[model samples]
Target chain A: MTQVHYDKIALIGIGLIGSSLARMIRKAGLAGSITIASRSGHTLAAAKALDLGDHYTTDNAEAVRDADLVIVSVPVGASGQVAEDIAAALKPGSTVTDVGSTKASVIRQMQPHMPSHVQFIPGHPIAGTEQSGPEAGFAELFAGRWCILTPLPDADPDAVARLTRFWEACGSRVDQMDPEHHDMVLAIVSHLPHIIAYNIVGTADDLEMVTESEVIKYSASGFRDFTRLAASDPTMWRDVCLHNKDAILEMLARFSEDLASLQRMIRWGDGDKLFELFTRTRHVRRSIIEAGQDVAVPNFGRNVQAPTDSAKPD
Target chain B: MTQVHYDKIALIGIGLIGSSLARMIRKAGLAGSITIASRSGHTLAAAKALDLGDHYTTDNAEAVRDADLVIVSVPVGASGQVAEDIAAALKPGSTVTDVGSTKASVIRQMQPHMPSHVQFIPGHPIAGTEQSGPEAGFAELFAGRWCILTPLPDADPDAVARLTRFWEACGSRVDQMDPEHHDMVLAIVSHLPHIIAYNIVGTADDLEMVTESEVIKYSASGFRDFTRLAASDPTMWRDVCLHNKDAILEMLARFSEDLASLQRMIRWGDGDKLFELFTRTRHVRRSIIEAGQDVAVPNFGRNVQAPTDSAKPD
Candidate 1:
């Protein structure tokens, strides 16, 4: 009883998102055959153990051969290499996409490598937890999250619509925007938050005056929230920073400027400004909750496994 | 059925933490009566609606008339006023404690106003969410969290132990630290995180280029986490920053230094440094979960209405 959305669906780079997609595709019977490829032999073996796909390989080209759909889920740094490695074997009329955090750079890296026959659509699913690796994936990961497609001006609408429908079935709201806008938007919401978390945690770590136990004990107050974000997979985040330098830097500069003003408020005991800013930020969280983007509590993993229709436990 | 650890417990400033104490005290039969006092008529009305206390008053002095145990849970900025307001009415042998975020200032502000007849103990419970107000409080807010007490050098041992036991009955693990050190520790964990979140959200708001839709739509990536912290009560956090200035500034400096180093890593493409810091931060989350400071999904409000002897809910 497979839905069979594609003749063959290929996944390049079987990490958290990739593995989850593979599993969802299988669960939904969305493909006749699935080929999984990653540069690491160990991950491929793990995929085999889990039987995440019908075929597994280390060679990107071997994985994509004759496939009707190809999804590249790798570090932004590796997008160019993966695009180059798999270009020759990508079948004519196949729809290709990459779930990279930074869309502009991915398009820049992968577009030139496209063999003209494949419809290359650069996309990002605004979904993930701090955890990574094949073992951390679940079928419901994409459900209720957003899938952002950054299609080239010349890209065919039918191909985009088909990909959008595929993500919808996997449980995602789809939106398309210019790649540059996507990059800048991600810089503020995703990249800036991460950089700040990493910075604060690293700062606390190096303090000679405050003992480690103190920070850990008091972390739940607010610092612990940053720690969860700071704990996100580093390799992927570093690539995001490297690949989206201009946007990230722009966002950082703005953030530092805002922080300096806040620091001034504290230094001068300007309670009104601090209070107003704090109160206004509350509305943003309300909007997100209203939009159903976040769980009520901080630990999303538990929310995912809870007996809620929103999170379907296997 | 009142276990009545104390004949009367008075709560000054019945907001999130205070109301929570009222709930837990009633449920556990730990106090013969819970008396809630707040400056705002609106807040007092809300607390009354929640059935959090047996008696309510607008005058702090009137509320503390015969209290055996009095907890002042006001903004750190308002600590001096609350202390001065209630100082004259405190019972001769009563234990007067606080649930303020900062201790040094709380003691400095309140000690001078307090009578020699009462035992003055400064304390804080490191438990909260972005939500505030009386209605937002849950009896389980302090479950498995920490309550830090900074007793004076000459404070009575019996008073300290009894107060510690009271918080313990509320489901908190109690610890002692120097007031100055406590401020320093909280600066890095709670204050800095909230400050950073506020700054980043403000920065996003100031952006003329990226539309609001982009920020909300893409927040799931990382920024959404910061919004939760940013949404915290303004008066509470603003007072925390002003009251804990010296420590907050020190932590801020360290944070900036680490951020500069991270910026250098990104600018130079030094992936390994970023990777190490990122991976190391992940362990802290694990530790927090293990310590039960955080749920596995990390933010489930505890099942407080259930009997304490029952095992944690599945």
Candidate 2:
């Protein structure tokens, strides 16, 4: 039988990450009993319908009571409220962690409400699809992905080690880092990319010269890529923007500065400069593929299916 | 028999689009004989090895001799040179076309050099993967994709119809539009997206605070999407930037303006504004999927594989 890392586990926020963890934990037999909680009764019911956990509750505190490990998977902006709600109910010696995108902001929001007796660790899993909700998750969501944990300076070593084992059991490789460094790294890698995608999609939508229908029809050329990122959950991204403001802004500024130079190259017909930059960027994708962070196949392997002669018009 | 569209089809430039067309035409029996030409002997040899055509040559003019149709699929900057080279040898009444990303620039470059006896149509097939070269092509590359044709004002209707039929047989739906309008539409849908992607990837590469390894390791979070577009063929993209400068500059201005507003919203903590924009962009992705322009699955159907418990860490 698979080893149980936690006797009772509490999941706050039955959204994509939370529900995915529940499914993985159940499939791996990492927990004896699971309690799922969400502020929305609709979401909680969805989790129940999926048979994701042994218990479901609308009350965060009620769900966390007597739980040996608690995972708060709400948006970064909601971390403080969830932390406050479950602080009093957390079992002594229990481990409390989160799956937020921004580390520093989550730490700032949830650290104060964490009880002294419990071990508090802030984590961000670098894995997800653009989909959300409990129904959108699966057991393999975390497999081959990295889960980063940002523990407090004085946190208990045994508790951190136990949480690491729990994530590894769920099919993630864990890395520990400083909360500030995590935010900085993610701003350039995640936050800025999402913001740029949203901005580009919005720009295309608002163009009077080019109709929206044209954008959608010819999107496979390049614009379709941004749409995937832009389609990500708005509420979650809004919170990420609000909570990770500084790092996101810094990265945005850098991106704009670089864009201006690229614009100049285009205006001046500097093909050499454009080629140089374009060539350099290609190496990054190769390295990413080599690192096993992305599929090496072209078009993300979306074109693997054989094309029929009678295929419908795009 | 499928009814051949042309007795002899000459392909000038044996890169991604050129080679894909050769494969498709041969597969569908759309052409009785194929003549492939490339400026570089290396590329000509590659096409010969693939058996992509019935006849292969490094001389563009020789390839076009006695051909019923001539399709030039080189970078936009080289369109004029190819047109000049093949003009003397193009059979009278033969149809001529190109598959460049920009229509107006290609028209401006090739129209003057084209013989009055032959139809000169500027075309852009809104299809491709990041990978390029003669080897990175398949018969299905244009299946279910839109191919826009920008025929000249005085062009023969019979020639245009014949070209449309040819593309249809190769698995593309054809649309006709003004060259200027095509450039404007493509600037927003294709050119701007590539520029923005390249710029962002360059920005991430330049960041001192975030190491390159971190960016690559955590890229699946979002940055990897841009890398695909950014990793596209540099020479082709550079020529696109130079050829479609005016329209691209206009789109870039608008995108930068929108991004500035988005930055201010992030800086001022205007969550409602961010949410509004984010929500609006999601519908665009849905429309693109519904229109058959992109895959409807999350992450472009990249995560469909079952997550094995023994999977290597990403």
Candidate 3:
């Protein structure tokens, strides 16, 4: 267990990331008391039901009143509103951070509302499943994942170090990056992939010739992989696309240009060019596996499951 | 145990599908003897090393001679060549089927060489992992998956029935479709997904601002799902693209148009449209899970593996 770094920790939104952080903080004894708040009554009650924190409230300001560390874990689109809600209640020297996918947008939304005394550190953990909500969280969510901190140039180093320690206690390796650069990097790595997945699933669903049943039945042929990503929280993704407009548009344009070239190769029956691209992409998966970002098991180990599961392959 | 459906079964091309069929046939006693053949001596040797068949040969004709059933599981581009090589040696009343991804192309390529006395049915098993080769095969590969057979209008019913029995013994639900329809359906379901995956991975790799290390480190946030499909066998995909050009190109055009519209929505900050598309696609994943085409387990059950693996989280 880690040291009790904060006397009180406030989680502004008790969803997947917030609840997960609560679990990890509790497990590691990093916080003496945790306060959880959610805009939805059902989510707030669920957090209380799960015993996710020491205090629970639907009022974001009430949760942050006595907290030394406040983490805003709401959707990117809600970051500014959340910041304004709790800005008056933040402690004098408390450290406030957010776990949002789009760093630049989150910083822009939350930075202005922060008090002059509190240090606002924008952070993102590069880990999650397609699942969401309070019960969808687990203590291991951030384990072995990278947690990025994009602090303002004038932010206090001591406060940044403390936040770094908290993430480390949660089993994440922390890295610092400029928020703009972080946005560009994430556009290629995360946002664009999700956008493409959502787009492809939409395309398949709208196809009159190929029925949805056929798409699902034959999905094991590769379509199902995209479905998992496409099935992600729609609100969160919609917010991401809206908030990270410039970077996402840039990546989308690049992706479309590349796809057009690939289409040209297929149209001309240029087997050699098609083969080259297909072959090169194979190595990227290998690199991801080697880097421990993904497992090397075939079908992502889907073929191996508990014997009692009805879907287990016989 | 299922009854032995064929006295002798010959498998041409000991890759993922061929070796898997050999394993299933052996497990169910579906064949009295199994003969495996591949163009590469290395593949033949690997098949022998795995004891995948009773007899192994690099020569397709020698393997097909006197065999009651021949399943060609080579790259689709090689279907015609294999049919030509085995045509003279195929038993008079035997059934020859192929597990190629594209049906119309396979029929166009193999029909001219098929002997009138033998039955030629083009088939595709809507199942596979990214991994390929002999060692990747398992007896349960076809279990709970769909096997689509596209037979000629004049094909013998008896032969088709026997092939259906064989696939049933291997634990698959069978479906029949016109070859052209099959091509169009597969273009949307299989070929297009793989192509998009390969294209996105290529796009990420080509990004100058986003280092490869950044992509790998942050991959768990949706990018990794596409990597698994992108890592599929290049030769097989290249062949699929070359042989099923028209259908794939048509699907690509449809996909690009839809993507362009989605891009417009993002560009114009149309959150409702984005949310509508994203929400609609979630039902497709639900349908796939309900149909037993995919497991509903989170992260595809990757979180269940033992903790000792190097990639384990904490």
Candidate 4:
């Protein structure tokens, strides 16, 4: 069992990431108790039904009172309100962090309300599935994944180290980055991909000539991969798009510029150029596999039997 | 076991689709004998090593000499050449089919060289993984997937029925579509998704702000899904882009237009627009799952334990 890092941990927004944290903390014995909070009475009752926390309340302030660690796991757009709701109730010397995708905006939203005696560190665990809600989370969600923390300067070093240890105990490897840099990196690697997926799925849905049934029937050809991301929580993603506007716009602009060039290459039947780009992008997947970011098996090992022979020809 | 549908089945190209057909035919006892052929001696040797056929040859013509069915699975750009190479040696009353992605282009490329005595039917199995080459195929690759055939006006009815039975025996549901319609549908469902995936991966690779390692490290956030399609056989995708130029261009234009509007929504903080699009697309994925085109489990059931409860919230 992991060492108890907090006497009472308060979890805000008991959705996928939040409930997953509660599960991990309980499974690892990292907290004496977990106080689950959500603005929605339905969500709070659901968390209670799931037995995900030792205590539950609809009032954020009531949940955070006397809690040593407060974790906010709401949509980025709601981070500031959640912070303001819980700020006056947070225990002195507690550490407050979040699991939002965008770091800079989350920091901007939550930092102003944090008490001077408490440590407010903005964090993003680079983990999740398209599924969300209290019932959709598991203790293993954070295993083998990277959790990035963007702690502000002048934050207590002990508090930062303690929160880092908390994430480590939850099966995440932790890293610190400037919040702005974290936002930019995540904009390219996460936000842009999700937005692109949503856009493409939307495009397919809007096509008149290509019937929706045909698209679904033939989706295994390639389109189904994008659907997983497109099916993610709409509120979470919408907030992300609104919160990280500049970085997302910059990435989207770059993506559209590159796509325009690619479209031109297709228009001109520039086989060499298309081949070059396709080939170069291949090495990135390989690198990702080698880094243990993804399974190397084919089709993400989905439903197909493993091949008996080598994958390479020569 | 499936009834023997052909005296001998000759497979040309010996790549992912070709080798998969070889394995399925062998497992289901659909052919009296099998002949594997490829232009590359290395691929031929790999097929032989897998014992994928009764006979193997590097000469496409030699393999098809006495075969009742000749299945060409080469890249679309090479379809014309393979047809020309094997046209004279094809047995009389035999059926010639292909597994090229773009049916119209494959028909245009191979039709002129076809012999009137033999039936030529262009087909595409909407099944594959990112892995390629002879060794990457398995018998289950086409199970429960769709196989589309676009036959010419003068094609023999008996030959078309036989080919349909052949695909069904190999565990695929068969659909007949006009070659032009097939190309258009595939452009939106298959080709455009792949092109967009490759384009996004390329954009990420070209980024100076986000290091490659960072992208790889945090890929599971969303970028990894695109990498799977982007890592697909480069040669085949390059040929697909070159051959299905017009339909692909049209789809790309539609996609780019939608993306531009979505970008404006983000820039203007139009959460309602974003939320509407995002919510509408979620139903498509649910429809896809309900249609049995994709798995209902989260993350494509990739390495995660099953959730214990319902996915929906009250």
- Choose the strongest candidate by TM-score: 2
lDDT of 4 by residue, A50-116 (tens): 9999999889999999999999999999999999999899899888999999888888888889989
Report the CA-based lDDT of candidate 4 relative to the real structure: 0.89
Off by over 4 Å in 1: A1-4, A297-314, B1-4, B298-314
A1-314 per-residue lDDT for model 1 (tens digits):
22228899999999989998987888777788999998899999998998899988999999999999999999999999999999999899999998999988898899999988889999999888777888877777777778999999999888888888788777778999999988888888899889888888878877888877777877788777787777788889878988998888788778877777888888898888888888878888777777766766533322122112211111
Q: Score chain B of each candidate by TM-score.
A: 0.92, 0.97, 0.96, 0.95
lDDT of 3 by residue, A1-314 (tens): 33338999999988889998898888778888999999999999999999999988889999999899999998899999999999998999999999999998898888899999899999999988888899988887787789999999999988898888888878778999999999999898899999999888989999999898899899888898889988899999999999999999999999999999999999999999988999999888999889877889899977653323222222
- Residues B86-120, candidate 3: write the lDDT tens digits: 99999998889999999988898999999899999
Here, model 2's chain A TM-score works out at 0.97
Chain A TM-score by candidate, in order:
0.93, 0.97, 0.96, 0.95
Q: Please list the C-alpha lDDT of all candidates, in the order they appear.
A: 0.83, 0.90, 0.88, 0.89
RMSD of each: 6.3, 2.2, 2.5, 4.5
Sorted on DockQ, best first, the list reads 2, 3, 4, 1
Can you list the residue pairs that collide in candidate 4? Answer: none
User: For all candidates, what are the clash counts?
Assistant: 2, 0, 0, 0
DockQ of candidate 1 against the true complex: 0.38
- Where is the poorest 10-residue window by lDDT in model 1 chain A? A305-314
